[model samples]
Each structure stands twice: as C-alpha cells, then as structure tokens.
Target chain A: MKRRLPLIVVLVTAIVCMALKFLNLGERGTTLATDLDTIVQTSYLFAFLFGPIHLIRLHYSNVQKRRVNWAYSAFLVGVCAVCTVVFFINRIEGPVSTFIIDSITNATDSAIYAMLGFYVCSAAYRSFKLKNVEATILLIAAVILMLGQAPIGDAIIPNTSKFAQWILDVPNSAGMRGIRIGASIGAFAASIRVILGLERSWTGSGS
Target chain B: MDWKKLQWIDVRILYVIIVVCLLIPMFHPVGLPVAISDNTRLVYNTVESVPDGGVIWVSHDTGPGNAPELNPMIAALARQAFRKNCKIISTSLFNQTFGPVTTFEIIDEVAREMGKEYGVDWVHLGYRDNAWPATIRLMIENIIEGAINRDWKGEPLDQMPLMKQVKSIKDDVDLIFCTTVGSPGYADWMTYVSEPLHIPLTGGASLTMYSGVQPYIRSGQLKGFLGGLRGAAEYEQLVGVAGAGLAGMDAQSLGHMTVILFLVLGNIGYFAAKRAGKNQ
Candidate 1:
C-alpha cells in the first residue's frame, strides 16, 4: 500500500494534467488548470520545508559524529540558522536581510562564478590543440567565434562577425534544434513511463 | 628554443596574463566600437514598438552566476521602457534568493533615475516559487492572483497603481521580455504563455545559450533576443546609455584577444612536436 498509493497518485495526476493540456474543455478546463496549479503551488510551499529540514538533519548528524570536514558542516548549519532567524525577524526585504544577502551571499556567489573565467582561459590554452581533422575544425570554429564575439574581431578581419553569425544561425542552430527535439521526445517518453509506474526509481525503492 | 615546451607553460602565467589583459583595458579605455546585430536590434525595436504606456512583463530568470551578464539587460530595458512611458511588471523565477533581490535593485535604481513612481510606472512582483509554466500560466490568467496580491516588498498589489491597471497578462501585457539563464525561462514563456496567447516573446540569454535560442528567433517565436554582455552592450549603445555593458566591452575584447593569442601559440607548439616526432 505504501508504494502503490504514491504510484496511484502520480498516475491520476499525470493523466489529469495531460488531458487538461491536450483537450478542449473550454472555460471549465481553464479553471481546472488554474485550480490544479494552485494546489501544486501549495503543495510546493509545504515541500519547501523539506530541503532545510534535510540539510539540518544531515549537517547536524555530521557535527554530532565529528566527521571529516564537520566544521564546515557546522558552519553551514550555523549560517542557515542565523539567516533563517534574521529573515524571520527582519523580513526578506528588510535592510539587514538584504545586506546579508547582497553583501555576503551574492558576493561569495559571484566571486566563485568569476573563477570560471580564469579556469576557462587555462582550459582553452591547454586543451584546444590541433591534433586531427575534427580538432582542426573545432579549433578554427572556436577561434572564429572568439574573434567574432569581440569588437577587435571585426577590426582585424572584416566580415568576421558575419561569418560568426552564419555559423550560429546555420550549423549551431541546426544542432541545437536536433538536440532539443530529441530531448523533448525523450522527456515525453520518460513522462509516460512515470505515469504508467514503469519508472519507480523516484519512489526511492528503485525500478 | 624548444617550440614544444611552449604548450607546457605554467597555467598560472596564463592566468596572470589574462588578468593583465582584462584589467589594462579597464584602466585605459580603448573605446572599441560595437556593431549592432539584427538580433539585438529586433529586441530593441520590439520594446520600441510597444505603444507608449504599454505594460511589459520583464521576467528576469537569472542568478548571481550570470548576474553581471544579465543585470545590464534589465537596466537597459527599464531605461528604454520608461523613456517611452511604458509600464513594467517584473518577476524573477530563477532563484528565490538571488534573482529577486538583484532584479528589484537594478530596476528600482533605473526607475528612480527616470523619476518614475514605483507603483504607477513599475512594480516588481519578485520571485515566485519554482512552480514555472504553471505559475507563469496563472499570471497570464490573473496577475494579482498569480503573485498572491503582494508586491516584491510584501506590499498589496491592489494598492499599487500599476497592478491595479494590470489584471491579467492576456489583457494587459504588450511584450514578454525574459532574460534567461536556463530552464523555466524563455522556452517556458514561449511555449506556455506567449505562443498560446499571441503575446510577443523576446529577451536575452547568456552567451552560452545564444545558439540554442537561434531556432526560435528564426521561427519568429521570439521577436528577437540578446546574447550575453555583448548584446547588452549593443542595446546600451542603441538606448544611448553608457552602463556596465558598454564599460565592460574593452575588457571583453582584450580578454578574447588574449585567449586567441594563446590558442595560436599552443597550436604552433603542437604542430612542431608532431613534426619532430614524425622525423625521429
């Protein structure tokens, strides 16, 4: 019953969603969709607590066990606790809350993301070698794209921007659309499998 | 000099060189001209074509990681929209913590500079939970209900003059400008909202996503779109504002040049090593 019940719920919800999306139920259908959306949203709000609860549980267990890098876990739990308290006390949009988010959270996030720039430079220098025909083509395309994206590309090679735009408009876009279409069909099949209870890995019991 | 050794130069030296190349342009501006692309022009013209006072739904679906590339886009959009007396209804669906706060700050800053009242000219609905196509679909039906009657700062939507004028996206919105980084972004808006309702969808994406969105542009599903900081810079130029996008172009130009230079050096070393090996 434990496993069957959840699968039943998924099957019903999936069918209802698909029918609502594909059928022409008119005004009634619109209202039903909206209501379903609200229900989903409310459920999501309730599920929101699951993340922090799980985080606290895992980290607190780590702290209690004195596991490797438990200090970082403890620090994370501490920050989450303080941030939660601060947010509740001062509201999410409050000056202090905003400062903590903007100054601490956002700054750290941006700094870490910025490190990607350095790594990308190093990666390109080391890995973008011309070893064979495929490598040569890729290398040429990369150089063209790099030049085309920058203002100096046009300055150095006239019409380089136009060449770059063509590559993006033609081959790149064609490849992306193929991937997108393939992925969409795969997603559709996956959804059907989930609906039919063939994909039960999500139920935590594995398929 | 052993040419093959060039490929093995310490990565730290390369990093320092890139840093210097990026930083030098910041201190000494090269003022490289940015040519506008058809894609960027289409985005600008779409916003321009919206009747004065038309409401634009600016969905800033981004995060702190892509903020530098995307924030300038919101600022530029706000400047252009406000200049023509258009109203803006903003939301950020990307992240609860990152997108909402940064988006509100950028739009609010531009709004203040333009002397546009927040409630009347623009109202940020803030970050909705990640209920995506559904949340967006609800907004198309009724904005007030979709946002739960609260503005970004927890203010009542009914109290806001802009919100009062805007009831539903279907009836009120003129354009959907989304700055997207990933899923629940332009694709969701295009498929679930814009295409069904016939509202024009257009906006920018990170350069990484530029190619992926090109098919939509070709199909006219997206009126046109911007591609990362370069696109933002071009839009800034068109809007006649010198903001972050324009400011960062020189650095970007030099950085790209530096990478290209290293690629050439690395390739030369690669071929030399290959030739040496074959001869031996």
Candidate 2:
C-alpha cells in the first residue's frame, strides 16, 4: 500500500494538472486552477525545508567523524547557522543579512566566477591542440568568434564580424535547433512514460 | 624547432598574463569601439516603443554571479522604462531570500536617477520560490494573489498605488522582459505568460545562454533579446548613458585576446613538435 498509494497519488496529480491545463472551465475553471497552483506552491515551500535539514545532517556527520577538511565543514555549518539566525531574527534585508549576502556572499561568488577567465587562459594553453582538420577549423572559428565579440576584431579584420554572425546564425543555430528538437522529443517521451507509470526510476530502481 | 619550449609554458605565467591583460584595461580602458547588433537594437526599440504611462513586468531570473553580464541589462531596462514613465513590476523566480535586494538595488538606483517614486510608479513583487510557471500563471489570473500581501519592502500591496492598475498580467502590462541566466527563466515566461496570456516577452541573456535564446527569438516567441555584456553596452549607448556594461567591454576584449593568443601559441607548439618528430 505504501508504494502503490504514492504512485497512485503521483498519477492522479499529473493527470489532473494536465487536464486542468488543457481544459477551459471558464472563470470557475481558472479559479480552481489558481487554487491548485497555490497549494502546489505552498507544498514547494515545504519541500524547501528539506534542503537545510539535509545540509546540516551531512555536514554534522562529517564534523562528527572528523573527516578530512572537517574544519571547512565546521565553518560551513557555522556560516549557515549565523546566516539563518540573522535572517530569521532581522529578515533578509537586515543590515547583517545584507552585508553577508551582498559583500561577503556576492563578492566571493563574483570573485570565484571571475577566476574563470584565468582558468580559460590556462586550459587553452594546456589542452587546445591542432591534431586534425576539425580541430583546426574549431580553433579558427573560436578565434574568429572571440574576435567578433570584441571591437578589436573589427580593427583587425572588418568583415570578420560578419563572418562570425553568419557562423552563429547559420551553423550554430542549426546545430542547436537539431539538439533542442531531439531533446524536446526525448522529454515528451519521458513525460508520457511517467504519466503512464512506465518510468519508475523515481522509485530508485531501474524498470 | 624550438617548439618544445612552447609546449611547456607554465600555466601560472599564462594566468598572470591574463590577469595583467584584464586589469590594465580596467584601470586604463582601451575604449574599444562597440558595435550594436540588430538584435540588441530590437531590444532597445521594443522597450522604447512602450507608450507613456505604460506598465511593464521585469522578471529577474539571475543572481550575483551573473551580475557582471546580466545586471547591466536590468539597470539599462529600468533606466529606459523609467525614462518613458513606465510603471515597473519587478519579480524574481530565484533567490527567494536575497533576490529582492538585488532587484531593488538596480531598480532603485535607476529610479533615483530618474526621480521616480517607489510604490507610486514602481513596486517589487519580490521573489517567489519553487513556483515558477505556476507563479506566472497565477499572476496572469490575479497579480495581487500571486504576489502575496506586500512589496519586497513589506508594504501592503493594497496600499501601493502603483499596483492599482495592475490587476492581472494579461490585462495590465505592456510587455515582459526576463533577465535570465538559465531555465525556469525565458522558457518559463514564454510558456506560462507570453504564449498563453498573449503578452509580448523579451529576454536578456548572458553570452553563454544566448544560443538557446536565439531560436526562441527567431521563432517569434521572444520579441527580442539582449546578448550578454555587449548587448548591455549597446543598450546603454542607445540611451546615451555609460555604465558598467560599457566599462567592462575593454576588459572583456583584452581577456578574449589573451585566450586567442594562448590558443594560437598552443597550436603552433603542437604542429611544430609534430614536424620536428617527422624530421628526426
């Protein structure tokens, strides 16, 4: 009954949601859908509770075990606790919360993100090679695109910008569209399988 | 062939060089001439074409990491919309706790510059967690219910005069612009709001995600799109204001140059090493 009840609930919810989306029940229908959405949204918020609980449990276990770099885990727990308490006591816009989010959190995140430029430089130096024709074409196209994005590209070769645009609008777009179509079809099939109960991997077992 | 030397350039040296290239340009910018593409112009014109006293919904679907490339576009849009005297309804589907702070910081800066009044001319509906397309769907049905009781400031929505005219997303807004970095973003807006509600939607995306957004723009699902930092710079240029978007272009240019240089040197070493082996 445990597994069967959950599966039934999932099947019914999916079917009802799909039906609600497709049907036009007039103002009453819209009201019902809105109510359903509110319930779903509230449920989502409840689900968000699991995230922090899981985080604390994992980090606490690591700290208890004195795992390698357990000090970092301890730090993570400390930061999480401080932030959560500050947020609860003073709300998200409080001075402490603001400072933590904007200065400490945002600054660190941006700095980490900025390091990508350096990594790209290093990665290109270490890994990019001209082993074959395709590699050469890729290398040239990448350079052209890089140049095309910058004004210096125009200064170097005025028409390289146009060539880059053609590359993106034509070949890149074509390839992307092909991938998107296949992915969309796959998603559609997956959705159908889920609705019909054929895809039960969510049960943590392969079908 | 001394290509062997090229094969083993210390990665730290490359990192130092890239940092120098990026930093030098920032302090003393190259002031490289920026070209405004047709798509960027389309984004500008779409925002500009909103009638005086119109209301527009701006969905911020990105956060701090994307601030460098995506934030400028938000600031630019806010500036343009404010200049046109458009009422702004700002919301986010991410950063449920701190996203409103980011949204307000951008919009408030623009509002101060334009002397626009909050709760009178603009209001932030704040961040809605987990409920995305549903949030959008409900907003189209009833904005007040969807946004809860207050703006991000905790002011009651009933008292906010700016929301008086906005009863539903379908009826109240002139256009929708989503500054997006990933999914539950442009796609969600297109699916839940634009297509069903028949509202015009535009997307501003980071450079990395521009390709995914292109097909939507091409298919007319999105009215237009802002392509990364360059697009933001172009939008700033159109409005005759210079901001971070324009300022960062120089550093971006130098960084790209550094990457290309490394690629070229790397390849040269590869081919030369192959030839030296053949000769031996």
Candidate 3:
C-alpha cells in the first residue's frame, strides 16, 4: 500500500503536470502552475525534516550499540528538538522565526562560502596542468583570458585587453556553444522520448 | 592509495603568483581593454532597445552559493532594465531560503540608487518552489497567485499598479532573464517557457556550466548568455559599473596566467630531463 500510494501519486502528478502543457485551455492554465508550485513547496518542507532524521538515526544507532560517537546521539536530538520548536514558533510572522531564518542564511552563505575558497584553491593546485596539446592551448588561453580579464593583463601584455575580448567572443564562445547546442539537442530528444514514455528511467515499481 | 606516497604540488608557489597578479592589477588595472562579442552585443542591444516601461521577467535563479558570480550580472541587468525605464517583474525559483530575499535586496538596492519606485516601476513576485514547472505554469497563468499574504507595503498583487498591467507572463514581459547554477535552469526555461512559446530568453550561469548551455544559445533558444563571473564583469563594464566581477576577474586572470607559466616551466623541465637522459 505504501509503495503503491507514492507511485500512484507520482504517475498521477506527472501526467497532470505534463498534460497542462498540451491543453488548449488559455488563461486557466496558470491554475495548474499554481498547483505545481504547491507541490514543489510541499516537497521542500519535507526536505527540512531529513536533516534531523539523518542526524538522529545515525546517533541513535551509535548510542544503542555504545559506539565511539554514541554520545553525539543526545546532542543531535537535543539540537533538533530545540530547532524544531523554534521553527514551529517563528511561523515567518514571528520575530524569533526571523532570527532563526537569518541565522541559517548567514551561516550557509558566508561561513560555507568562506571555506569554499580554500577548497577551490586546493583543487586548482592539485589538478590544473598541461598534460597534452589541448591542455597546452587551454593553459595558454587561460593565461590570455585570465590576464585579459584582470586589469593587470593589459599592463603586462600590451594588446591583451582587446585580444582577451576576441578570445571570449570567438574561439571560446564557439567551442562552448558547440557543446551547449549538442547537449540541448540531446536533452530535447530525451524529453520527447520521456513524453512518449520511451524513456523509463523514472519508471519501475517492482524493484 | 598510499597517503604518504602521494606527490603534492607546491601550494606556496601557486599562492605567490596568484597574489602577485592580483596585487599588480590593484596598482595598475592594466587597462585590459574589453571587447563585446556579437552575443554580448546582442544582450546589450536587446536591453538598450527595450521601450520605456516595458515589463521584463527577471528570474534571479541563483543562490548565495553562486551569488558571487551571478549577482554582478543581476546588478548590471537590473541597471539596464531600470535605465530603460522598464518595469521589472523580478522573481526566483531557486534558493528557496535565499532566492527571494537576496534577489529583492539586490533589486531594491539597485532601484534605490537609480531612483526607481517599488510598485509603479518594479514588483518582486518573490520565491516560488518547483521553479521549473512552476515558472512555466506562472508564465502560462500570468497572475502571481503564490505570493498571497505579503505585499509592497502589506498590499496584494491586484492593488499594486505595477502588477496590474501584467496579467500573464507573456502579457507585458519584453524579455526573460534566467540566471542560474547550470543546465537545469536555462534548459528548464528553454524547454517549458521560451522554446515552446517563441519567447526570447537570455541566461547568466556558472562558468563550469557555460559550455553546456552553448547549444541553446546557438539554436536561438537563448537570445544571449552571460557565462560565469567574466560575463558578469563584461555586463558591469557595459553598465559603467565596477564591482565583484571585475575584482574577481583580476584574481581569476592571474591564477590562469600563473598556471600557464607553470605549465610551460613543467614542460621545459620534463623535456630537458628527457633529452639529457637520451644523450647519456
């Protein structure tokens, strides 16, 4: 019953959602769009629950077995409980709710981003190389683009300013555009296949 | 995977060169002249030709995760929209937590600097989940039914003069701008909204995903595209505004240049050692 219910929901939702696009219905079609958003919003609300669930399940198992991180069980549950309380109380209309939202936003935005710089630098250090001809060209192009992009490129290389501009527009754009067009064609083909139910990647209930 | 046996690239060398390239630009912005491409030119001209009071659907499809890169384009794009005296119908489908808030903050700040009004000139439809289908649906529906309780000053979409004229997504929207993390974004817009209806769509997306979105641009599915921070930098340049994109470009450029120099040096080192051994 549980499996059947979700599948029925998915199939029904997908059909209705997909059908709306094909309808001759003029202005009324927007009502379906509003309904679609509500579906997405509900999905997101459920996602907020997973963060706590994972933390609790992991720690609960650990504590029951007296594992190394067992003590974290209490900590995880306690924090989740407190946050849940605050979340429910704030209601987007409450000042406390605003505080909780702001706190999450700040940490996710600034703190997370601040740490990403180091990771990006580390990744660049370990991986960036000219292993072959294309790599060499890319490296050279990188220099041109980088220098040309920055204020210093014009100073160091006399004509780099205009040169960089040409590179981004012509060669880089051409290469990038080729790949993008290819991908889009592929996606369009796939979407058509899906609409026809030729693509069943999202199908399968037996497994 | 032997942890200690792994060869480590010299981190300090990379840092030194990156720092030097950045420092030089601070003192001498090298005046690297910028040239607008036909595509970028199209983006520029499209905005330039927009009739005054035209309504633009500006979808700030980026989160704070990509705000550093995409926000500059939004700022510049907003500047152009405002300068053209167009009414911007700004909204977001991504950044459920941050999408609406950040986009609004940016538009609000830009509008304030430009002396634009809130409802009369622009209206924020705010964050809507299920962005792809929702956006498509909204475009089909026209009236924003999602933002129910909130208002410009505790008012509704009907009360707002700015939104009154826009009955559906297609009614008054002159152009569609979808700035996002990658293909899912531009692709979604192309498939659901622009391509099917023949609506002109443009994009600003992550650099890594730029190539991936090129086909849509080539196929005329996308009118113009801003690829990564550099694209944003160019937009800022066109707007006569200097911000994070230009600054980041300085850093990104130097990093690229330094990596190239190291490649040449490494290749020389490899070849020299190879040739010396061959002779011996």
Task: Give lDDT tens digits, candidate 3, residues A75-189.
Answer: 7777778777877776654677656556766556866864665456656445445568886676667667666555556667777857866676567668776776798799988
lDDT of 1 by residue, B116-171 (tens): 99899999998888877778778888899888888877899998878878899999
| Candidate 1 docking class | medium
RMSD of each: 1.4, 1.7, 5.3
Q: Report candidate 3's interface RMSD in Å.
A: 4.4
User: TM-scores for chain A, candidates in order?
Assistant: 0.95, 0.91, 0.62
Worst 10 residues of 2 chain B by lDDT: B92-101
**Which regions of candidate 1 are displaced past 4 Å?**
none
Better of 1 and 2 by TM-score: 1
Candidate 2's residue-wise lDDT over B157-254, tens digit each?
Answer: 97878777778888889899998877668888888788977888995988888878777777788887988887888888988888999998888888
Best-matching candidate per DockQ: 1
Ranking by lDDT: 1, 2, 3
What candidate 3 gets wrong by more than 4 Å, as runs, is: A1-207, B1-9, B16-31, B149-155, B272-280
Number of clashes found in candidate 2: 0
Model 3's DockQ score: 0.35
Model 1 agreement with the true structure over A1-207: per-residue lDDT tens digits:
998999999999988888998899999988899999988888888889898899999999999999999999999999999999999999987999989988998889889988999998889999999888998899899889888888889999988878988898899989999999999999999988998999999998898
| CAPRI grade, predicted model 2 | medium
Interface RMSD of 2: 1.5
Off by over 4 Å in 2: A67-69
lDDT (CA) for every model shown?
A: 0.90, 0.82, 0.69
Model 2 TM-score (2 dp): 0.96
